[model samples]
Target: MEEEIRVEFTKNGFDFDEEEVILKKCLSFCINYKLSASDIVSSWDVYSLNRGLELTVRSSHMGAFLEQLQNEQLNKVREKESGLHLYSNDVAMILDGEYEEVKEDMLDTPTSKPASANKQPSDSTGKISGSKFSSGKPQESVTPFGQRKSKFAVQSSLNENHIKQIVKVEDHTNSEDDIIKRVRPNQKCTMRIMSSQPKPGCRFMYDRIDDKFNFLENRIKKQAISYVSAGICDEPSDPSIASQKSIFAVGMICCEEEGRLKEKPVLLQSSVEHSGGQRVRLDFQKLNQFSVFPGQVVGVEGLNPSGHCLIASKIIDYVPLSVDSSDDHPSKRQAMDQNLQMTNLSLDVPELSLIVAAGPFTTSDNLFFEPLNELLAYARRKQPQLLVLLGPFIDSDHPELKKGYMNCTFDELFQLEILGKLRDYVEYMGSAVHVILIPSIRDANHDFIFPQPAFDIHPADFNHQIHSTPNPGTFCANEVKVACCNVDILKHLSAEEIFRNPQGGSKHRMTNLAKHVINQCSFYPLYPPAEDVPLDYSLAHEALHILSVPDILILPSDLAQFVKVLSLEARNEGERQIKCICVNPGRLARGEGGGFFAEINYKGNPDSSSASIIRI
Candidate 1:
C-alpha cells in the first residue's frame, strides 16, 4: 500500500485572507522537499491553526520515505534567509519519527501491522500507533467534553459470542422463544431487551423493532421520576374527586359537562395533610379517576405519613386568585375553565410587586425610562396602587462621546439631557406610582461628581409617592409596606434619585453593585411567623405571604446572584416548615422561558368539610 499525507492549517478567528497565506506557505515547504506525485501516497489536507493536518502512509516503508522528505525540506529552509523566514514564521514541519508506531496499524494492511479488535494504543518505540495529540501529550481516548479517558480501561465490551447472540435475537423477533432468549441475563450481548412476556401457548404479537430499539426503556422510566416529583403530572378537564374504594376521602364528583368523557370518577387520596393551611395531600392516585386538568389547584383530604407520598382519596375544588389592576376592566382572560388564569394584579393590592432598573444605561434607551414605563403601565391597568423602584436608575459613569468604535467618553453624557430626561420621567411616572428607590454605588452624591440638581428632586414628588425614610416604612397600598436604602451614605435626599444618576469612569462598578441589591430582594425568603413552626408544616403560607404583598419593589438585574442565594435560604426555611417546598410554578415556568406574567382566578377555597368548583 502507499502513503497519504494530508496537509491542514491551524488558526483561531483568522480572517479569510490569512488562511490563504497559510495554504500557500505549506505548498512552498512541500516543493522545497523535492517531493513528487509517485512519492506522495494520496492527498494532503489543510487544517486550521488549532487543528493540525494528519498524514497517513500506504505502506510500512513509506515511514522512511516521509522522514527523508522532512529532512530535505529543513535543509532547504536553513539555506536561504527567505526560506528560513517562511519555515520559522509561517510553516513548521511535524517530524516523521513521532508517527512511526502510527505508521503500522493505521496503514491499510499487508504492508504494516494487522488490525486489532481493540483499538487501544500499544507500546511502540518513540512513536504512537492509534493516539491523539493533545497539548504535546498523546491521549488514549477523548471524552465528548474533550478530556482523555484512561488508556488501561476496557475499550470495548462486546465479543464475537455477543455479536452472534445479537444476530440470533434479531432473527427471532415476536416469538416467545426469541423474547426469552433476548432476556437471558447470562447470554453474551452488548444490549438487553425487557418486556412483559405472555404465558406459554398464549398468542401474542408486538412491534419487535420497538421492543428491540427501546432496550434501555427501564433506565428511561427511572429518569422520568424526577419530573413526576416536580409536579409534571397530566391534567384534564373536570377531574374526578373520588375512587371506588378510598380510605381517606377528599371528595367525589362526576363530569356531565359538554365534550366530557364519562368514566369512573377519580379518587384523590393522600397521606399528607394540607399543611400549607389548606387540606392538601401528597398523592392523587385515588383521585386519578377524576378529570383534573393540568392547571387545576385541587385539594386533597388525607392523613400524614412518612417516607412515601400520602394518598388523597378525595379532590377539592380550585382556589380563587386575582391580581390588582387600577384599570376598570381586566385586559386578559383568566384561565377559568381549568385552573390557569391570566388575571392582572395591582401593585397597590397589598401584594408585593417589583420594578427594578439601574443607571449608566448600556441600552439604547435610558435605564430608568424602560422600567418606569412598565411600572406606570402596570399600575394604571392593574392598580395595586403601590410601586417600588429598587435602585440606581441613572448612571454617572458611562461616557458621553465615542472617539471611534473603540474609544468612548463618559464625561459629558450626565450633564446633557440624560439626567434631566430621567428626572422628568421619574416625576411623570411618580404621580401615579409609589416608588422606593435604593441608592447604589454609582450614586451622584457618593464620591462620583455630578451637577447638584442631578441628585435633587421636587418635594411634592417625594411626599407619599416614595419610601425613602426609616421605621416600618410608608405604605401607599393596603397590607403592604416598603423600605428603601442606598449602597452608600448620601442621605437626607429624596428617594427617587437613588436609582437615577449620571454615568462616569466608574460606571461598571456602580452597575454591578446595584444589580446585587435587586437580586437579593427578588429572592428574599419569608422567615416563618413563630406561630407556624410545626415540624411538618409546608412553607406555602409564608411564600404566599411574601408573594401576596402589593407593593412593587424595584431592584437592579445584576442582583441575580444574590437572588439565587436568597432562593437557597428560602429552600432551607421551607424544608424546616414543610416536608418539601413546592417551587413556585410561575418562577419555574419563567426559568423555562415561559411568559412573564402568570395569572390565577379561583372560584373560592372550599369549606374544609366539603368541596366545590372554583374557577381559576
Candidate 2:
C-alpha cells in the first residue's frame, strides 16, 4: 500500500512563532541529557517536520532562550527532517568579549554624546582608529541587537599590555535568513533570567595581593552578545578588573566575612580545609600548632585534589597571628625535685589488680633511668588491665663483686632498691594485683657446696642432692604460683647425677616445691593431653601458666618473645590453638607498651588462613 505524503500542520509554511516555541522546548530537553545548548548549534529544513517532536531547554533562562529552544527541539526536528543533526560550539568567549566592548563604547561617550558621535575616524569605514578603551584603532564588535563596532577597539582592549584581558565567544549564522527561519529577523525577543546577582548564600574569600573580592555576580546577560562591549565595564568602571583575572574556583562555599571571630582561623582556598579527607568543615580542635585558618588570604603550599576534596599541606597567611599561649608562659608547668622517692607506682585502672616482680633489671645505680615510682604512679592513674613481673632476682656472683665476703643474699643485697621500685610499680598497678615469683639460678646459688636436692629443680645446685625428685616451690605473701628454675642459666652446667631425687629437711621447702609442681601442671592448657611434658621443664610452659592465671598479662619484649615462641610451638605440635602478639621494646621499657588482648567468636566454618602481623 502506498502511504500518502502527510504534513501534520505546516501553517501554510514555516510559522516562526511555533518553530521558536518548539526549539525552546527542545533546548530544555537537552539539559536533562547532560548536554549544553550554548555549546552546540541546531539546523533543520522546514520540509521535514511532520510528526510532532519534543525539545527541552538546558536552562530555563531567556538569555539562552533562542539557543536553548533550538537545542531542545533539534533532535525531533532532525527526526522529522530525516535524522539530520545540528552542531553547536561554545561561543561564550567570542560573544562575551565583543558585547563588553560595545557596552564600554556606549558608556565612554557620556550621556550627552551618542556612541556614534565618539566613533573613531576609521569606524564609519569599518577601519576604526583607537578610542578611550581600545588601541585608538577600530575593532569589530557585535551585539544580539545587531549593534556593530570597529575591530580596532576590540584589539586594543585585548592588547598584550592589558593586565586583565577579557575573553569572548561569538555565534555566527551561515546567513541572516537562517536566523529568520525560526523567528523574525528584526523582532526583539524577551529574555528569561535564570539567576541575577548570584544567590544570597554565595560567599567568597578575598585575595590580598589582588585586593579584590571574589564575587559571584551575573555579568553575562546574552549568549550571542559580542566581545566589543568592552567600553561598558572597562578597567575604570570596574576598578578591580585590572587586578583580577577570573572567578574563584567553583569548590569554595560562602561563609561569614573575615576577622569576625577571634578564634576562627582563616584558611587559604588551596589549603586542606578538611581533615580525614571528609567534606565536613575543618574544626579548630583538629588544627595543630601550624594550622591555618579560614578567611585568611593565603597562597598555596601543598595541595592534593584526588580524593573527596582538596588537601593542602602548606598555606601562607599574609597577616600571621600568635595563638599559642604556652609560648608566652613556659614556667607555668611545675618542676619536681630530683631526689623525690618513687615509692608509689599506682596505675588508674580501678577494675583490675597488678602484680609485677622485679629482677636484676632493678638496681640502685640505674634508679634514675628506671624511675619505677614515676612510671607506676602514672600507670596507677591509667588503671591498666593488669601488670605482672615473674620474679626479682639479682646476680650475686659477678666476678668483680665482693658480696661473697659479706655473705649477703642476692635479694638482701638489692632489697632496698628492688623493694623501693617494686612498691612504686605496685602502687601504680593499684590494689588489684596477683604477683607470682620464679627464683632465678643466680639468686639461689650456694657456692656449689650445698647438695643439690633430688627434687630441688633449682639448676644452680649441680653437685648437691639428686634422685630425679621434684621439689616443692616458694610463693609470695599473696599465695600466687611461685617456681624457681635455672632453665636458662643451669643449661650451661652438668648437674645430671645431683638433679635426681635427694633428701630435703624442712617441710616448708618441700611444701613450696610441691606447690610449684602442682600449680605448673594445673595452669598449663592440657590440649592433646600432657603425655610426657615435664612439670617444671619449659620456660614457655611457665609463661603460659602465668598467662592462664589472669585476664591480662604484662611482660617485657624478651619475655613476650618467649611467649610468642611457645604459642608457635603449641600450634606446630598440633596441641592447641594459640594467638601471639609482638610489640616494640621501647614502649615496654617506658612502661607504656603492653599487648591488649581480646577474644573473637567465629560462627561460620573456618578457612585455612595464615596468621598476619601488623605494626602500629
Task: Estimate the TM-score of every prediction.
Answer: 0.22, 0.21
Backbone-clash count (model 2)? 123
In lDDT terms, which candidate is top? 1
Q: How well is each residue in 75-193 modelled by candidate 1, as lDDT tens digits?
A: 45644433211110111122346345434535545554545324323211112223422112233123121221231122112123533454376466535563453344321111111
C-alpha lDDT values of all predictions: 0.26, 0.24
Stretches of candidate 1 exceeding 4 Å from the true structure: 1-352, 360-384, 401-432, 445-456, 467-616
lDDT at 25 for candidate 1?
A: 39
